[model samples]
Target chain A: MTQKYYAQIYVTLRPSVLDPAGVAVRSGVQQMGYDNVEQVRIGKYIEVTLNANSEDEAKTQLDRICDLLLANPVIETYRFDLTTVSSEVQTS
Target chain B: MTQKYYAQIYVTLRPSVLDPAGVAVRSGVQQMGYDNVEQVRIGKYIEVTLNANSEDEAKTQLDRICDLLLANPVIETYRFDLTTVSSEVQTS
Candidate 1:
C-alpha cells in the first residue's frame, strides 16, 4: 500500500513589498475603534494530501509543485510542514 | 507602556463546502506527473500586529475582528495564535 502524506503550506509577501491588502485591513481595524493596529499582512494557507511510496519521494514532488505552480516568485515566499496522514498516534 | 501583540491566524473552509481552487491545484499536480495527489484545500493566513493594554484585551479584540471581518460564517472557520511582539526570549 502507498503511504499517505499531508502538508500545510504558508505563503506570504516579502516585508519590503507593498501590500495593499494589508494596508487596507490596518485602516479598517483603526476605523473599527481598535486604534491599536500596527500592521497586517495577508497570505495563503494550503492543505494537501497525497500518496507516495515514501516521505522522501513525497517531499520531492511537493518541492516541485510549490516551486513550479503554487507560489508567485515576484513578491511572495513560502514554507511548509509535512506530516503523515494517520489518525492514530503512538505514545511512548 | 502598551504591550505589543502579534497574531498568526489560519482560516480554512469547512469540509462540506466545495473548493474549486483546491480541485484545480490537485489536477495541476497530477498533470505535472505526480499522479499520487489525493486532496487539496486552499485557505488564508493572516498576520497582525497591534498594541494592547494586556493579553486579555488583545484576545477580546482578536475574537471580534475574526468574527466580523476575518472569516465567513457561512463557509469558513478560523483559529489564531497570539504572542507578545518581543524579540527577547527568556530561557531557564
Candidate 2:
C-alpha cells in the first residue's frame, strides 16, 4: 500500500566551518541590544512531500536525496524527520 | 543561576506565498530522476546559543528574537525548540 509522507530536513554547517552570513545576522541582533546571544548559526530547512510504499522506503529515498542534493558532506551535515500524511488527500 | 541553552529555530514561508526557489530545486530534483517527489519547500534553520536565568526567560528572549531579527512576519512564520546545555563548558 502506498502512503504519503512529509519530510522536514535541516542542513547545517559543521562547527568547524565559518559562517559569515550567520555572523552578520548575529551582529545585527546584538546591535538591537540582544547582547546575551552568544552564537548564531544559520542553515537550510527543507520540506519534501512524497509518496512511498512504506516508511522504510521513504527513509531510504530521503537519505539518498539528502546525500545527493540537500547537503555538502564536507562542510555541512543534514538530518530529517518523516511523518505519515493523509494518503487520501488527492484520491477523492 | 544563569544556564546555557540552545535554540533551534525554523522560519518558513506561509503556504499561500509562492516559492520560486523551491520550485527551482524541485525541478532540479525531478531532472535527477526522482519523479516521485511531489513538492519541495525551502526555509531557514537557525541555531542560537544563549544564557538565561530560567526557561521562561529563554523562551521570552527567543520569541522576541524571532519577532525582531530571525523572521519576517509578513510572509514567513517561525517556530523554535530550546534545550539546556552544559554551563560548565564556557567556564572550563
> What CA root-mean-square deviation does each model show from the true structure?
4.1, 1.8
lDDT by residue (B6-25, candidate 1, tens digit) is 99999999999999999999
DockQ of each: 0.77, 0.83
Tens digits of per-residue lDDT, candidate 2, B7-75, equal 999999999999999998889888888788899999999999988899999999899889988888999
Model 2 lDDT at residue B90:
59
True contacts kept of each: 0.86, 0.85
lDDT of 1 at A33: 91
Candidate 1 per-residue lDDT, tens place, A1-92, comes to 67789999998998889999988988888888988888999999999998888888888888888888888878888899999977465345
* Residue A82 of model 2, lDDT score: 95
lDDT by residue (tens digit), candidate 2, A15-70: 99999999998898889887888999999999999888999999998888889888
Each prediction's total of clashing residue pairs, residues at least 3 apart in sequence or on different chains, is 0, 0
Task: Mark the regions of model 2 whose C-alpha exceeds 4 Å error after superposition.
Answer: A88-91, B88-91
* Strongest candidate by lDDT: 2
Residue pair clashes in candidate 2 = none
